[model samples]
Target: MADPIDPSGLGRLLSETMSALGQFGGGPQDDVVPPEGVGEAADGMVRAAVAPPGRVTALALDPRVMRMASESLAEEITRAVNGALADLQEKAAGAVPGQVDLGGLGDQLRRIQEDAGRQLTKFTDSLIEAQDRLARQGGK
Candidate 1:
């Protein structure tokens, strides 16, 4: 039989790739996030915000087994979801002005919303599955 595939390399590659992507998006996040209840904060700023619609594609990941790969797969799915959501926000914003007619607008909006909802549900489910897989791997 052929030699077993080395999962360590795959895991390392994935982890590095994830780190690069995260840095590319919004730099690294602060290690500690401030509590929300502290009243006024700073001005609005953009950061890599993972969106919901990409939950499945982001999460539909399976890589050779290594602890690093497991973590990377999870992170990628999360990042992908955020990226998907960002795109949706842009689309929504752009379409808002074009949808002037309230009735027609409502119909169009409803369709879009329903489609997004379906997709989001699918992605979320996939993410959950991925997480379960990760948990199982960890248990082993």
Candidate 2:
């Protein structure tokens, strides 16, 4: 009988490789359910519900807010929305399980690439220097 393919093993290997390359984390995180964010303004007279990805899923405005000037209402709404989006971002960052922090990884990867380029440049320069010396000796 032919050996069965171990798809899970292959998936794990790929996931590990991507993670090592500072790409993403592995495994399903549905269990770590994300929490919704709420932003309130004017003593909760205006509220915004923000879901994942900074989406405003809903907005609630108290009837009292209607009595305020139009400009004031607009400002309150804007403030609520901004607060909700910021809250959502924080929640989303904390929601994922086994999530890799890319903040430092990006800088680390850039430094590695820069170091590699410098080494390559040095190697090329050495090779050229050797060749030039050899050419001068051969001419003599």
Which candidate should be chosen as best, given lDDT against the real structure?
Answer: 2
TM-score of 1: 0.28
Return the top candidate by TM-score: 2
lDDT of 2 by residue, 1-140 (tens): 22333435445544544565745544446665667888999999999988876678999999999999999999999999999888888887776557576876676666666655555566567677779889999999
Per-residue lDDT tens digits for candidate 1, residues 63-125, read: 332334556545554454555566656754553323235565456546655655555566567
136 Cα displacement, candidate 1 (Å): 1.0
Q: List the residue pairs that clash in candidate 2.
A: none
* Candidate 2 local lDDT, residue 52: 74
The local distance difference test score of each candidate is: 0.45, 0.75
The lDDT, on a scale of 0 to 1, for candidate 2 is: 0.75
TM-score of 2: 0.50
